[model samples]
Target chain A: MNTTQTEWNLARRQIVGNAASIGFAVAMYGVSFGALGTTAGLSIPQTMALSLLMFTGASQFTLVSTLASGGTALTAVIASWLMGTRNAAYSMRMTPILKTSGPGRLVAVQLTIDESTAMGLAQDEEAFEGRASRLAFWATGLSVYLLWNLATFIGAVSVSAIGDPKSFGLDAAIAAGLFALVWPQIKSRTDLSVAFGGALIALALTPVVPPGVPVLAAAIVAIIVGWVTGRKLS
Target chain B: MMWFAVLAGAAGCYALKYVGSIIPAHILEQPIVKRIVLLLPISLLSALVAVQTFATSQSLTLDARVPALAAATVALRFKTPFILVVLIAAVTAAALRYFGLAA
Candidate 1:
């Protein structure tokens, strides 16, 4: 039952399709981030390079904003690193679902991120094919990576001819797109509680902490609370 | 100069991704660590939304942008398609901005 052939094929197809969907959505948000990077004094090449290389949207945004606000390069790097540390956790949690053999294992790790990891894990509980999980992660990550870099390049090069990208509502569009991705997943009391805890913590600490650090702090608090809740329930 | 940072950052990011799988399964399966790891996405994503929605240039706004939050709430409640909810939020925000009511 756990490793049936037909089920594996179906899961593979579903994962691929969802990966494409997630990839396309994530790519759309790259336009906004690219514009933002340029406006923050990043050259087109730098912005595109960031998109191509860094590939984590939140961390990229955090680094640029921190730098723009007079943060040292080291500080910006640290902040971004802290923000993106979730990928490490994602990789740890994903081991059971994506236990690939041979060379493809490397690809699985590279592709693991918030969306792919989350989607893959969600499917795994339903016993999705291990291959499907890997495919989804790669398809989504590669698609987003390519689209993001390309979009950033285009935005950076066109900035002089274009007016404020914010005025074009790019920020809102991206925010909306992200919300689109996130809103569907807020199920159960546990999920809601963590969200509430995180939001409250961030709001409370925003004035005291640096921009991105607050998010990291809130995340820590949320995880603690969630762990405590799970223990209580058990 | 920035490219150096970018390249270094990217390399670091990719290298870190593979670190978990390379470690012994026992390391990843530690009960406490496993619990925390499993909760990472929920916590991180929640924090991201809180920062984006509430903090605006170091201040919190309860204006038209508020509708984006509200729309998200309603969409989640009704189980509407995520894309539709986002579109609604954007439209609501644009209307608020149009009326000179939002920051």
Candidate 2:
């Protein structure tokens, strides 16, 4: 849904409503991520950097848990990178809508995560009335980014005062949140198969391989599935 | 090591995003590449679920998190919000742990 400049004049308030809701939801997770990061032994600044740079919740959590579980730096990076790959996929879709370069492109690409993309594309109605989607994108992205970072900082600081996070079962909270994040993406039969296969592969390999390797190794399932799908389409 | 991990992971993840941003849409739209891209996050996230719930480094454990995950699954089926799903799972595990049921 490419948004034209002439179509962007409205800068509708409806976009803000959607962005705020998404922002609030993410604000909750930002707190969780912040708390989880500290419990994973990340300093506030380290955790902040993750929220700031990586910006995506799944990738940040992946990095924390991987490193905490004694995965090597290489594996940690790769595993988190794998988790972050969806943004790349999101980026591919966002490129046309964003249609910017230089400094603007840098900022837009950074904001190109699930929330913004979802909001942006939601306006791609049956007609070519993709007018408000770009506003949705920018508003949702900026708001989520700001709220998430602030909440993350708050969570990081306050969690330490809460004593051992396990008592609060924050670990389970993190996993559940992550599963929720991915669940929306599981919309098709192929997606289901890949998820089941990936989890199976990871579980089987967990006891055998290093901490983060199984996560990476699960890519085999996706590759095979993709290959089969591609062959069918061709 | 952690500092390196954090910084490097951020760099690499952003680089991936940059690649997607810069790549020609036609190139990304290649059937195989598109399929693979779509599936990567699905597989990786499920792999993460298995890892998060069951495994700890080179070991495996059966803990309160097991039932907690089941509860989370139910919450998902009911279409609970993301944070609520997480809260339900957390409370499930916490209560189990409190009662000395699971470890």
Candidate 3:
């Protein structure tokens, strides 16, 4: 085949691979989130709205969990925003790569989350690099967005029929889903150490701090470790 | 109150993303920023897992989530399919609860 045709095929394969890797997992997790949101006292529409608009798993979960526990609106918003800051960082990393414009730019911003960014960056550096990366981004972003929303609707509607969400162990599913997403990223001893340190920080602070403070504190620990270790290595 | 929080959260999140998108690439590509971004997800996600697993209504406790997390970790280490990892974790927790071992 000609170079262009071969490149197109490679890009297509990469997009499909990336989408398939995380799409179902994300959709399933969306169901869990939807049920949790409803159980947390959010109306079905409100739960759906969070997924449609906020569109970040950890942030949405933080918002609902905080609210469910009687946290003030300000606290919930701050917690969710803090959790979402990573998406901003993801956007910065992806902006030059996406180079999108107009309406597409708006949509791209909406879809810029951990899964899409990771999928895009996972593209092979050696083959049809740019095109494949963009394809992976769009493919994973679009598929996850569509499937997640649909699953949210289903979960919200079926929540009553499913009865108590906790009895089904849905409460633990969030951590499991997050764990799955984070697992592939920890590639080395340093990464593992950082992860353990962060977890320890969060755990140690959980009892003494406000609902959301532990997470922010853990982020600080990670940042300090990153800065210190990075300086040392450099 | 709920509506206000949702709208504000959405707007804030969108702003965060837009600000990142508009920043000049050269600025974001700095070595320190790059390292921060690389390390951020690991720490953030680990924090998330710990909070979600251990905290219940601003309080910490030992519960089924601990063992479920352990199971999920093992499943992940084995490169189990994502769905299976979730299922294993959920089932582990549910069984523990059913057996009166956890709340």
TM-score, per-candidate, Cα-based: 0.69, 0.91, 0.83
Whole-model Cα lDDT per candidate? 0.64, 0.84, 0.80
| lDDT per residue as tens, model 2, A41-118 | 888899999999989888888888777666788988888887777788788887777667899889888898889988
- Per-residue lDDT tens digits for candidate 3, residues A1-234, read 898897688769767976976777788878877876887778899999999999988778778766764566777787677667778788988887888999999999999998999988887644564877788888999889988888888877777567777777877876787788678889898889888888899888877777666766777766787788777666
Instruction: Give per-model CA RMSD.
Output: 5.3, 3.4, 3.2
In model 1, the clashing pairs are none
Quality of candidate 1 docking, DockQ: 0.35
Candidate with more favorable, higher TM-score: 1 or 2: 2
Error of model 2, residue A125, in angstroms: 9.1
Ranking by lDDT: 2, 3, 1
Q: List candidate 1 stretches off by more than 4 Å.
A: A1-22, A32-41, A57-79, A89-108, A114-161, A169-178, A226-234, B1-9, B72-91
Candidate 2 clashing pairs, residues 3+ apart or interchain: none
Candidate 3 chain A least-lDDT 10 residues: A123-132
| Per-residue alpha-carbon lDDT of candidate 3 for residues B41-67, written as tens digits (9 for 90 to 100) | 688778778877888867887899889
Model 1 over residues A75-165: C-alpha lDDT tens digits?
Answer: 5565566556667767777866677757777777767777777776665454543556556666676766666677677656665457654
DockQ of each: 0.35, 0.73, 0.59
After superposing candidate 3, which stretches have Cα over 4 Å from the reference?
A1-22, A66-71, A118-133
- Which ten residues in a row are the worst by lDDT in model 1 chain A? A165-174
TM of chain B vs. native, candidate 3: 0.82
